[model samples]
Target: MTPPPMITDRDRDVIERYADGATLQEIADGINLTRERVRQIVRKHGGADAETSRAARQAAKEAGEQRAQIEFLAEYEAIASNLAHQGFTRAETVSRISVLYPSIDVDVADEALRASNIVFDQNNDTDVFSNVALEAGVWFLLGSELRLKPDYAWAAVNLPQELLDELGTHLSEASVTPDELATVLGIIGAAQNAAMSDPTLTITGARYNELRSELLDAIGLKSATGTKPWPPTRQTLQKRYQGWSDALEAMGLATASLGRPKGLLAFSEDDYANAVIDFISAAAAAGAEPTFAFYGEWVKEQAADGTRRPSPASVRNFYDGWLPALRKANAVVAARSAEANLSVE
Candidate 1:
C-alpha cells in the first residue's frame, strides 16, 4: 500500500480548515488534494482545538448575520420612510418591498417596517397616519396661538367644510409616532370626561396628572417606576408639544389652576365613610389589622379600580382624627357583619 503523503504546510492548512468546520472535500478542493488525503492530515493532527475552532466559527457566522441585518435596516429605512411620507401604510409599503426585493422575506420586511419608525396603524387596518394627522390638527388648532385669530377661532370650534378640507390637507402630512398619537388622544378623552362634570373648559396640570393616572388604571396599563408609561410622562408630553401649556392646548383644553385641590375634593362625605368602611371590612376579611399605615397602602392599591380614594391625611381630616376614624369604621363593619349573620340565621 502506498504511504500517505508526508505532512506539509499545505496539509497543515487543510487540518486548520477542517477544525474550523470545513468539510474534508472543501479543504481538499481549496488545497488541490484528494478528500481522503485531507481527512488523513486532519486525523494525524488529532483534531487539536477543534471545539475552540468550532466556537470561533460560530462567532464568525453570527457576526456575518449581524452585518447583514445592519445593511438590511439601512436599505429598508430609505424605502419605507419615503413610502410613509408619500402616504403609504405599513402594509402597503411592506408589500411593495417584498415584490421589489424578491430575496427579502415578508417577515423580514415586516420587522424592517416596524423599526423604520414609519407610522402605521398597528391596532387596525385603518390608516392611522392620516387619521392621527387629521385629529392632531383639530387639537392643534384648538391649542395653537392661531386660535386667537378671529377666522381660525370660529373655524376651530365649528370645523366647517373649508376648515376640514384645509386641516385634512395640512395635518395629514405631520409626522407622528403611534405612541404619541395614542397618548394625546387618550388625554383628550379623559379631558372630555372630566369636563362633563365640571364647569371648566380647562384643567390644572395637577388635575391632568391625576386624570392620566386614572386613565392608565382604567386601561389596565401598568406604570413601572423609572420607566415610561403607555401614555408617556408629562415631561415627554412637554417635550413633544414644546411646553405643558402647549400640550394642554393641543388636547383642546386650557390650564384652569396650578396645583392639585387638597383632600380628594372629588369624593363626598358619604364616599369617605364608604371607603373607610370598605377598608376595615377588607382588613377583617384578611385577618389583618386595619392600621392607618395599612389603610394608606390599601388606598394606593385601590386606585387600580379607578376609584380615587382619599390620602391617609385626608381620611384623618375627614374624621377629625385617625384613631376615631378607625373606631367608627370598625363599628360600621361590625354592625354589617352582625346584620349578615342574623340574615343568614
Candidate 2:
C-alpha cells in the first residue's frame, strides 16, 4: 500500500503564498526556502507529484520555445514561397532571403539544401511534433472558445488539406508579381531622385541614404561595389529605369512618352486620375518612410542660433508638398497616354 503524503506547515505556507500571487522565487525568498523546495511543497499540496511537476515545467518551457521556432520558420517559409510565386530567379530568392533574414542562419542552410536537392523526411510521429500540436491545438481551442469566430472553428475542424488550400488561395492573391512591384518601385525611385536633386528638399543625410538604397533595391539595382564615395552607378540607374518602364507597360499605360525626359510631367485624363488615386493611397500608407536627422558642426551652429528645436510643420510640409506634386504629374501622364491610345485607335 502507498504511504500517505506528508502535510507539513511549510507546505501550507507555500500554498498560501502561491495563492497570494507570490512567484516561486518570491515565495522562496519570503520563507527562507530554496526555489526547488518551495516548488516541491506547492506541487504536493496542489495534488502533483515532485517528478510530475518537474516534467510539467520542462514541457511548458519546451512548448514555448517550439512555438517561437514555428513562428520563425513560418515567416521564413513565407518569404521563400512569395519569391517563388513572383517568378524571381532561384538565385534572386536566395540573395533576397539572405538580406532579409540575416540573423536566421537556418535560411542560409535551407537555401543550400534546396539548391543541392537534399531532402530530409520530417517524422510527424515524434515527440516534438506531438507536443507542438497539443500546445498549438489547445491555444487555438481556447482562443476560439473566447472569440467564437467561425473561421477558427473551421480551421480546427477541417483536415490539414482544406486549411492548406484556403491558406494558399489567400497567399496567391496577396503575392505581388515582380513586374507589378517593379513599377511601383520605379515611381518611388523617381521620387527619391527628385528629392535628392532638389536643393529645396531638406532631409537628413541618413534618411536620404536609406531611401536611396531602398529605391535602388526595388528597381533591382546593386549598391556601389567598392568603398568609394562616388555616386550610384549609371548601370544601376539604367536597370532601375528599365524595371520602372516594364512596370508602366504592365499597368496598361503608354511607356513611350513616360520613358522620355519630362514625359511624366505631362498626362492624359485617365492617367491623371489613376495617378491621383495611387499617390493618395501611397501617401496615406507612407508610414514606412524613413526620417532624416541632422548632426555634425551644423548641430552646434543651430544650438548657438537657438534653432535646435525640431519643427513638426517643416516635416509635414515636405510630405504634403512633394507627394502631391508627384501624384499630379503621374495622373497627367496617365491621362495623356489614354488620349494618345484613343487617337491611335
Candidate 3:
C-alpha cells in the first residue's frame, strides 16, 4: 500500500490557494514549493490539475465563441432578408451592414450569408461593397492612434494631398486591389522615412534596400496574409518602375555611391573589414590563407558558436573587390602584429 501524503500546513495552503483559482505555479511561488509538488498536493486534496483547468477554460472559450457566432448569424440573416425585401442586392446589403455595424467581422458575415443558400438581387454592386470596405480599411489602419512611432516615424500627420487624392480616386473606382493600396502606402512610407531627417534626402536603390526593414516597421507592414497585403518587395518595385534607377527617379531620389548595397546596415564598414581581417589572422594561425571559398565555412563555424559574422558579399562590397579586401585585411593584420611586437619590446 502507498503511504499517505504528509498533511503539512504548506500543503493545506497550496490546496486552499488552488481552490481559490490560484494556479499551481502561483501557489508554488507563494509557499516556496515546486510547481509539480504543488500540483500533487492539489490533486491529493481533490482539486483539478493544471491540465484539466486549462482544458476546461479552452472548451468554455470555444463554446462561447460558437454561441456568439450563432447569435451574429441569426441577426445577420434577419437584417439581410429585410434588406433584400427592400430591393437591395447582396453586395449593397453587405456594404450597409459593414458601415452600420463596424464591430462585426464583415468577412465572416459575407461568408455566412453566402453559405446560407439565400438568393437575392444580382448586380455589379460587389465592387461597391469592395470599395466601401477598402476605403474604411485604409483609413482604419493608417489613421490608427495605436500605430508605433519608431525612430523613423513620419512627421506629417497626414499624407500629401496628391497621394491622398490618388487613394481616393482608387477607392472611387468600381474595382480596387489590396496590391494597389500596398504600393501607394509603401512609396509614401519610404519617402516619408527618407525625408524624416533631411527633407532633401535622396533614396537610391541601395539606400532604399538598406532602409527597407526600418521603413516597413515604421509603417506597420511586417506580415502579409491572403486578405492583407504588405509593402512591395524590391523586385516588385523594380518591375513596377522598369528598373531600379527608374524607380529612384520616379521617387525623385538619387544614389550617392555606385558600390553595391551592404546587408543589414547594423554592421558598419569597419565591422565588415574587421571580420575579414580576423578571419585572415585566424587562418594564418592555422597555417592557411583566408580565401573566398573558405570564408563561407568560417562564417558557419562562427554562427555555430553563437557569433554573427558579416556575409562574404557584404565584405567584398565594403572593400570593392576580393583582392582589395585581402590586401586590406593583410595590411590590418601586419599593423596589429607590428603593434604587438612593439608592445612586447
Candidate 4:
C-alpha cells in the first residue's frame, strides 16, 4: 500500500480554487503540480465537477500558444545560425541538431531548415580524410569532444576489413577481452548518457576524464562495438548503448558487474526511487506483475526507449526498501481497522 502525500493548507487552497471553477490544469500550473496530480487531489476533495470559466480557459490556451511560438522561433534561429557556420549534409545537420538539442524533433528541425531556405555547404575537404585501418591495439582519445563535433568524426576511422586475415587478428575472440569490453562499453554508454547538456546539468572533469579514458581504451584497442567485433555502422558509442544488453549478451559477456555501474555517473536517492516507481507503475499499467524477474527482463529487452534505466544495484535497493515499507503500511491499516471494529462492539 502506498502512503498518502502530506497535504498542507496550500494544498487545500489549490483544491478550493479548482472547486470554485478554476481548471485542474490552471491549478496545477499555478501550484507546480501535474494536471493528473491536481485532478486526483480535486477529485479526492469532491471538486471534480467545477468547470473553469471560458475566459480562464482562453487565457490558458493563449499562454500555451505563446510559449510554443517563443520556443519555435528560438529553435529556428539557433538551427539557421548553426547551418550557416557548420554547413553539413541535410541528414548530418539533422543528426547534429538532434544531438545538441535533444528536445527538438528531427522531422520538425528538418522541415524548419527546408522552409527557412537554409542550405548546408557540404564538407568538400572531407575528401582529404582517408580511411585508416584500425589495428588491434589500444588507441588514445586526446579530447572530450564527442561524435557530433566537426573533428570528432575524424578521430576514429573505420576502414574496410572484409578481407578476413588468416591470423584472425581482426574480429577474433583471441583479441577480445570480455571484462575489458564490458567496462569500456559501460563507460562509453555512461559518456553518451552524461555527455548531453542543454537540458542536463554538467558533470565534473574527473568524471569526464574517467569516461574519456575508457572510450580512449576502446578506440585504442579497437574494441569499440562497430569498428572491432560489431558492424561498422555501429560507429557511435550511442550505438553501443542502444545495443548495450543485446550485444554483450550475444557475445556471451557477463553483465553482473555492469549492474553496479559505479564506473558511470552518480545517481541520487530520489532518482533511484523515481526510477523504481516508474518501472512498477509502468509494469502495473501493462497488466504485468512487477517482480524483480519481470523488471530484469524488461531492462534487457532491446531498443533505446530513452528512459532513465535503473541498475541491478537500484533494483535490489527498491526490493529491499519499497516492499517492506508497503507491508508495514498494510499491517498498520489492518490493525487500525481491527481496533475500530472492537471499539464499535
- The stretch of ten residues in a row with the least summed lDDT in candidate 4 is 133-142
> What Cα-based lDDT does every candidate model obtain?
0.54, 0.40, 0.54, 0.44
- Against the hidden reference, what TM-scores do the models get? 0.33, 0.21, 0.23, 0.19
Question: In candidate 3, which residue pairs clash?
Answer: none
User: Candidate 2's error at 242, in angstroms?
Assistant: 28
lDDT of 3 by residue, 1-345 (tens): 988777888777777666555677877888787989887778787777666666665776667666666776787788886554343556777889989999987766776666554444445323222322322222233323224232222312323345445454543342445554544454445443433223234434443333443444465433311112222233344444456554443333333434344454868767777888778777778876466657778988999999999887777555644444665666676788899999999
* lDDT tens readout by residue for model 1, 152-207: 33333323344344433332334334444443444333333333233235544444
lDDT of 4 by residue, 1-345 (tens): 966666779778977676555777878889899999887876665544644544555676667655654565575666654543332455677777678778876666665555543434343322211222111110112113333222222221211223123213433443645544433333333332232211122323233335433543455433422122221212222133344333222222223324332222466544555555556666778887455456666665522565556665564544332232223233444677799999999
TM for candidate 4 is: 0.19
Model 4 misplaced stretches (Cα beyond 4 Å) = 1-12, 15-62, 75-78, 81-95, 103-345
The TM-score, computed over Cα atoms with residue i paired to residue i, of candidate 2 is 0.21
Could you tell which candidate, 2 or 4, scores higher by lDDT?
A: 4
| Highest TM-score against the true fold, candidate | 1
What stretches of model 2 exceed 4 Å from their correct place?
A: 1-33, 36-40, 43-47, 82-345
Worst 10 residues of 1 by lDDT: 141-150
